[model samples]
Target chain A: MRVLGVDPGLTRCGVGVVEGVAGRPLTMVGVGVVRTPADAELGQRLVAIERGIEAWLDEHRPEFVAVERVFSQHNVRTVMGTAQASAVAMLCAARRGIPVALHTPSEVKAAVTGSGRADKAQVGAMVTRLLRLAEPPKPADAADALALAICHIWRAPAQNRLQQAVAQHALKGPIR
Target chain B: MRVLGVDPGLTRCGVGVVEGVAGRPLTMVGVGVVRTPADAELGQRLVAIERGIEAWLDEHRPEFVAVERVFSQHNVRTVMGTAQASAVAMLCAARRGIPVALHTPSEVKAAVTGSGRADKAQVGAMVTRLLRLAEPPKPADAADALALAICHIWRAPAQNRLQQAVAQHALKGPIR
Candidate 1:
């Protein structure tokens, strides 16, 4: 399964593509960050993100798009930007019929490093080792994006099945 | 100046259009809520919002889009949804080359009512009076949407000039 992971942010959105099933070794197809100017208006920044994510989708054509689920952090303003960027990523994928999955920061860390509490350096080191790359992806955000894809790929088979069932049910009609 | 105001929400996105400029009687061109299933996936709901906003833009062809600015509050989850929805609204407007403006809830209240701390009912009543409506728009969100348009229209003329200068500078290139 080819999956694209996105660590969404306004200043630097990280994107990475990983290809392979859960059991087999995964191949890193690409890794990069989409950066927008800090001083730009909020609306223009979002439009830039949409264009960036759309370009990635057009190039990689991943079967699934994995995005880091945003949570309320102490920095409310920063969190709002993250939430907005993530929305753009998901919208781009969903528009093209690509399945989108959301994984928490801790979940991505646990998937790469043994512990959910692992720090960024540890997660980056493990990602480098797992992907057999000469060095870790730069900007930390890029590494986190790859981790999100790894987490989605490593998720239990049963969980994926349940998610598929939910997606199918959603298509049937509105639950309300 | 024709303005389309959006009160962005995942479940019920309120949209209203007002035509005319400051110091003149404003006309209510349209008002309604875009409802999406509560149980839908986040990406799907965003897509629905984009479609709804697009339809409104097509029908009204407002020169400016005014959206309520999202601020963090006690409810983290709800605030994230609001931020995301606002992002989508802004994106739709920006993509079409229509200028988008953001008005805080307090600003909207102050523009229509004498006080910024006015309650929803008070704001609604004032909106009805300002627009010469027979009754307050249904659903508090719809009224709030109109208030946003009114607020944008009533912003100090100097501020609009400053904003236009900044927007023009942004088009030149990345400030950073």
Candidate 2:
């Protein structure tokens, strides 16, 4: 399966596309960042990010999209921008009928480096080695996005099974 | 001018439309909420919000969209969802080239009730009085949205003049 992972931000949104499934080698299709000027209006910045993600979706045609699930940050403004950009990415995927998965930062790190507490450099090295790249993707955000794609590709099957089980249990109605 | 105000939320997004310019009486064009169940997936909920806002914009054809700017809340999850929903509202307006404005919660309250610290009941009471409603809009969110629209209609002219002045000053190329 092909997945496009988004590391969402207002000023710089990182995008990476990977092709693979679990128990197989993953290939990097593309990686880049979409940037909007800091001076731009919030709405304009969001529009730019939306257009960028739409262009990537059109070009890559990934079957699934993975976005970083935003948690709290010390800086409220930063967290707000990240959350906004994340929503734009999900909206683009939903508009294109692509399934979207959200991976937490620790989840991505754990999947890529076998340690939830792995540092950025460790995750970056793992991504480079796993994807067999000549060098690690620059600007941290790019490497983070690749990690998210890898994480989603590895976790989706099991997650899908869990979702199915929940659905089945719901259909069976509450314990009476 | 006509304005559509959006009080964004994941579970229940409030929408209100009003028609008028500064120094003139405003008319209530419409008021409602777009609800998505809490049990729905996040992406699905966002998509539902996008669709709801799009439908409102298409039907009302508002000249401007006023969204409540998200602020940091004690509850991180609540703030994140509000930010996401706000982005969706702004995107709908930006897509259609309708001017978008953001009003703070305090600004909305102050505009309608003459105090930034006014409580919800005070704002609701003022909204009812201003709109000549027999009773305040239900669910508080709807009233808050109307207050936002009213605030924008009142504030937009001065804000535009200020923006124009800044642009003009910048064009003159920094004073020697």
Candidate 3:
């Protein structure tokens, strides 16, 4: 599957597109960041985010989008910004009629590092080694995004089975 | 200014494109809902959102995009869906180089009802009265979006002044 992974943030958003299936090394398609000036108005920053996502969508055309699910954080402002940024990404995928999956930070870390609590550096190193790349992906955000996609790949079987069961149940028609 | 207001949701997103300034009745240029099947995968839902936003952007070319900010909710799934929908709208604005403003529920309610605690029906009534529409905007979501644009207009003066003050302060250099 072609997966587009996203690390959503207010000032900078990391995006990575990769293609591969389980038990195989993923191929990197594209990776980049969308940046907004810290001093810009909220509205302006949101516009910058939107533009970046659209450009990425138009260029890469990934079949699936995977994003990190936001857990509760101490800073309300930061959480709000993160939520908004993530929302923008989800919307982008929706517009393209692609599927979107969300994984927790720990899940991604575990998928990339062998340990759920693995640190960033370790995860980055593992991603590079697993992908057989000479160098790790640039910027921490990019690596995190790639990890998210990897996590989705690892968890795809259970997700697919659940979806199939649900579809079958719905197809049975209304209960009397 | 032409402002596009969006009420982001999973099943149906209400959008309104209006043109006007503070203290003046805004003209409704266009209004509609972007919808997706509940049974659709998250990715497909996102694609629907993107197409809907793109269509609106193309039709109206609004200079500003106003969206209702997401708040904490009891349902994690609902919140996730809402966040994804909001992201699509934000990206749509950014791709076009248009500014986006996010308004809190309270802020919009206050703008339309003089009380931040006002309920949806009251806000809808005010939107009808303020815009001189023959009837209130259907589906509280659409009216709420219109209210958000009105809130932005009301708050623009203070925001502009703040921006100018910051600009002037930067010019003055470091304090002794």
TM-score of predicted structure 1: 0.92
Which is superior by DockQ, 1 or 3? Answer: 1
Query: What is the lDDT, from 0 to 100, of the residue A119 in candidate 2?
Result: 97
Q: Return the TM-scores of chain A for each candidate in numbered order.
A: 0.89, 0.89, 0.86
Best by DockQ: 1
TM-score ranking of the models: 1, 2, 3
User: In model 3, what is the error at residue B116, expressed in angstroms?
Assistant: 1.2
* Listed models, DockQ each: 0.51, 0.39, 0.24
Once fitted onto the true fold, the runs of candidate 1 whose alpha carbons sit more than 4 angstroms away are A159-176, B161-176
Question: How accurate locally, in lDDT, is each candidate?
Answer: 0.88, 0.88, 0.77
Output DockQ, candidate 1. Answer: 0.51
Tens digits of lDDT, candidate 3, B20-78:
87777677787778888999776677777888889999988876678888875436557
Decide which is better by DockQ, 1 or 2: 1
Model 3: per-residue Cα lDDT over A1-176, one tens digit each:
77889999978899888788777767878877888777765545666676687888889887778988886443545766787788777766776667788888888988888789999899889878866778888788988887787778767967656766888989997678
Instruction: Give candidate 2 regions above 4 Å deviation.
Output: A156-158, A161-176, B159-176
How much is the TM-score of the A chain of model 2? 0.89
